[model samples]
Target chain A: MAKTIEEINEKIKAGKAVVVTAEEIIDLVKQKGTKKAAQEVDVVTTGTFSPMCSSGAYFNIGHTKPRIKLGGGRAYLNDVPAYTGFAATDILIGANALPDDDPRNRVHPGEFNYGGGHVIEELVSGKDIRLVATAYGTDCYPRKKLETWINIRDLNQAVLFNLRNAYQNYNVAVNLSDRTIYTYMGVLKPDLGNINYSSAGQLSPLLNDPYYKTIGIGTKIFLGGGIGFVAWQGTQHAPNVLRSDNGVPRRGAGTLAVIGDLKQMKPRWLIGTSMLGYGCTITVGIGVPIPILSEEILKYTAVSDEDIFAPVVDYSGAYPQMKSDILGEVSYAQLKSGMITIQGKEVPTASLSSYPRAVEIANLLKEWILSGKFQLTKPVAPLPGVESGITFKPLKERPIED
Target chain B: MVVSKRIVLHFPRRVVERPIVYRLVKDYDLEFNILKAFFTPEEEGLMVLELSGEQTDYDKGINYLTKAGVRIQSLSQDVIRNEERCTHCGACVTICPTGAFELDPLTRRINFYNEKCVACVLCIKACPPRAMEVHF
Candidate 1:
């Protein structure tokens, strides 16, 4: 029997008729339990949606103004803190890169010699918003000592406190475990001109030569592992940069563990969970210059890993979505296709391009659509440039080997 | 189930004193008493105490600390919102488990009455425009 809108909504809202069937639900409940039903829904929906949309992008479950988007990659596994220190450090850098040059860039008062970090500000043409990051300081320790310092309980408290201070200042936070960072370790010995993106017409001593200039906007320079770009050397500094990665510029041995930490650590105080394993670092780097010519110059390094499951702030840009189920059961049938709609009406989903959780949510939405269950309304007038932001390729599904 | 005999009220890192008639009330095995406590807000991470005692004991407790020139007042809600940054996105309106915020249907914004606020800051996380200011 064809179900009416009232009937379907009633069945769905009342939990009378199960969508997938009793046996499937029973099998899923047995395999993953009640807690994992939503996750299993994710896996199924993601598979169904890949053909419909792009990776790292989504038109949010219920609305469209701020398109639900995804960023970073999965890093922590099994509570075993991977990139524990590295994750915190990325937040430090990511927070520092805010458009506003706030003095609270450094986490610790005395940690960095300089008060303000180096800034990288780029206005990518046709891009949604300005991309920027600043570094307050750069200090290198034997990685072992760095790890040990992070493990100490008191030291950990102090670091979190200081990181919180930094986050508060920048109005940003980090999701430590679910942050996906692409790390390049032991990739360069600092001996080769291969990395020298300088636009010197003639090749001389690559290291000692201050004449080294990066390629202008037109020329293409190769970044190993299929990542190549017309790399332009930004403002240079005389400081000694680390250079000990394997020859494979992209496939360095070290792990770039993506964490779930928010770039801003303000959320930590409310969460009752004891922060056991978290680490951070903030390094000063010259702003990578974007060519006035092209947006394609924005290259994705092999270290580029996308985080598909982190919550993002609303269009207002204050905080991520709160965990309360404030919006009751708005049926999947009411979702519209082209216009990002919420509650059967089109509204901004907030540009979620930089959000880490948009992909997962979008995938869920697509599955709900494909099942022939939703009443989708396509926008009468298509939103300009909205379609281009969706990344088509998704990360290959991680197979669960029996 | 563990019965909680006492609870420590830190009182915003401040010290205060009061000598008033009080009674220890048992609400579901948890004992709560209104008594004079000491707090010094000037010092960071200071402790505030609430004593469970009789009228004479309360007087004695107040007398013990009154000489120290402690101020006394009812606990006030911590003001977390920064007036300058608050765009009032109605996030706090949706997040407050208590009906602390009432939206102006005309403006589509929130009116925060702190008396009703439980200080949960769920709205702080929900305010994506970066509006919620936390004094804490």
Candidate 2:
């Protein structure tokens, strides 16, 4: 018997909803079968905590006494440059933005101590941030320069609008070259010394709903330790990709563009990270609950680490050149075991994503649903799925022609 | 009574030219391994040494250095792992040369054994959250 989201909400309102985490659902379906488990479980919560580089926030700083027109001027938050091409007092800051004095990669493995991501985290933590803006004197707004300290509570609006996040699946990065290399995936030692991967595996949101059956635009989720929603299909979202026997994607595929009120978020869930030689990025914690509307949806939620596989890519040659060659494929189970055999040699593995934190977020979301503090919402529309016939395109470099 | 200790010796400028380490082996009958040493002609000299001998002899050797105006500090507490900042992401588990980091099988949490750490400082950069810090 299939259930509707409306019915699930009614059960949640009455405090009778049967909520389980993605980790728990794996065993539940195995013991009780999909048919019986689907009838019993109302929602399965999923979570991931990893570095999401394509994230940022927009803030509407209140107009100053003289009202500086910052739209055509320049603005900076904590010495980090912000995009001020919008209306006066409105500015956007990306997670990867660095200060003018940041040494960056000039020192080989640069230490990005602070950046836009740190500003966002400090803002969410209610710390006062220094805002500096310069503009040309105008009639309506004659202030040439203005500097002030602003807090999230004082801002007219602060919204976390990420372009891409919550990657469905990603590659396991390794190095085949004789020299050590530093990348966004972490440091890869020479001669396949170590492997680094970024994914929550079975507890990931999109992996639990491979085909986007229950996840889509306007889907409510736990973002940065606060309530948020899926705004759209994230940038570089490629649903049409190679898949395993099950519906899970074999490589990096689906992604989500999420939005939420930055004022309600916590600093712990949104951390500022410095990737050795790769500059800076923000580590975001996101949790999406999959409503079990049918047995198939329930089965998808039961996907385990052993069933999910990620391709091992050599970052030295293939990734830098945008080549499609891969070394081999390894399962999450093998990765979690702390070792995997690659090219006839046993290699150690590490994860950039925090699995323990992912589990905590999933359990917190489940508690919210069970206590009736949170309710599920049906997506207003579906995302482009496998049948969309969308192929991820590479950049075609062309010279300027008159 | 035999014991081994890794200690950092700071030689004051006045005693920089003295053979303080030679006395540990010749007079105190202790085995010494110098891990790192930096010295200038007229400046303070610094040396990280691992010394092993009888507990009484080790204590005497340290006393002899202290009397010579050389400051001694333990090397065990140099590298520190801040518990609040660590997310247990396991990035340090693989990069650490001495296997100082261990991931618990059940909890998936990283256990940092500072005793096994050689203060190589590799985990300092490998850690994304900057949880690992070296005081020296």
Candidate 3:
């Protein structure tokens, strides 16, 4: 027997049924409306914490590895920091320290992308990895050197999408006609001090779609217009294929690749292999760890105080339901009194005027969904602005609330 | 010991048209302290400066710039301020790519810490009033 609407509703409520198509989503949205549509179905939330950082590990990796504490070394001498303490061959790994004591486990910012289960496997496997991808809303001017860098330290395969290469060759694009024609030149590897590949000479790696277009002397490259480029790369390549310039087996193959300004491609990463004849492929060599040199010590300094401070905030069980899919489509005007929460505290009881920010954030959540940039499984709370004024003020004098 | 330091500056030509004719002077009156600022003739929009302060002062300024919105870039030592529009609200006081700006102790005016700015546009974008500009 076919399932009745009530049975379907119960199944969805119990998280047994999944909406597979846009039509189903529309039907569900129409049936329940906005608020309840969320509750009827599974709504994932994510919370973010300010990152915790260290000065950096100083080390030298030859046949034998030697390590040194970064804090105890001479900062600079004769206008140059001495590199005598360690070799430049050390691999500097940026790490995020999770709060071990807190029962409510939350990932620190920049350490991992968001979306999906909070479990380590889910995060490492790249499920629901959170990201904030933005495109120029209105046709605006592009810059000649608006560079974006994605440092690939590990060969971990993940889904990468929403790629765009914008150009500001001219000062500004006042109108669609005035838009500078962007002629996407070739990609470059400054480390190699040479061009890697050219858009003209290389086969168009761009996924053929109307949204992807060239404008203003081909100065700006917008994929899918606001539409973006998506690709996946992860095939078992030969382990020792990649090596250092000296030809020694420094590290594994396909571990690091830097994407300069390519108006034709969006900056994204996705796990899995590509369908035949789609997306450009690039190989990265994880080469021997670059030793930490004395002169380069300052480069690793955590200039911002944030690099030293750990966040004091925490996130827990839902105190506010930003929206209730079960409530059906309620207009913003109908957004009830108690639909959102923060830090495990209920919204209504807290009676904080900042609750509206949650609503503003709800709109951001909807936009995140439409962008298809990431599917989150944790509470991705926006990092509230923290003030670290120039003049040092004690905690009591600081303008912030824990 | 005091010495005149040689500096090479790359600045925008439109605002700083005459590099040689116009001396690079900071409102704070910083001179004979192992620091000198000058606009370069080769690059109209570029300025070069040399500063000799107790090393810690440089570090503090660089830290301030990184926090206030200055972008620390690789490849070159540069400070690029776009003059097309400068609201001068003082966000750059903290957002300098290298912590190059300071509030004058008495006048409360913005002072340039030439050796500290790294040319990051964090302040330029953060400026709600849209007064400052960053080139690189």
Better of 1 and 2 by TM-score: 2
Cα lDDT tens digits, model 3, A1-402, are 222334433544454543321112334555665455543443211111101111111222222112223222322211112133332222221121122232222431111211111111122332332211122222232211111221222222222121121100001000112221111111111211111111100001110000111111111111211122222111211123322232211111111111111222222111111101111111100000001112121112101111111111111111022221121111111112212232342321111011222222223333443344323221112111112111212235557788
lDDT for each residue of candidate 1 in A1-402, tens digit (9 for 90 to 100): 222334433443444422331113335545664444532231111100000000000011121122211112112111122222232233122212212222232432111111111110110011122112122222322121121112111112211111111000000111222222111100111111011010100010111111112112222211111112222222211113212131111100110001111111222111110000111122110111111111111111010111001111121112234332222221111111111333343421111011112222223333343354432221223211212232223247799999
> Interface Cα RMSD for all candidates?
15.5, 0.7, 20.7
Which candidate do you rate higher for lDDT, 1 or 2? 2
Candidate whose lDDT is highest: 2
Ranking by TM-score: 2, 1, 3
- Shift of residue A314 alpha carbon in model 3, Å: 19
Please report, in order, the local distance difference test score of every candidate based on alpha carbons.
Answer: 0.23, 0.93, 0.23
Candidate 2: the clashing residue pairs are none
lDDT of 2 by residue, A156-187 (tens): 99999999999999999999999989999998
* TM-score of each prediction: 0.25, 0.97, 0.19
Off by over 4 Å in 3: A1-402, B1-19, B22-136
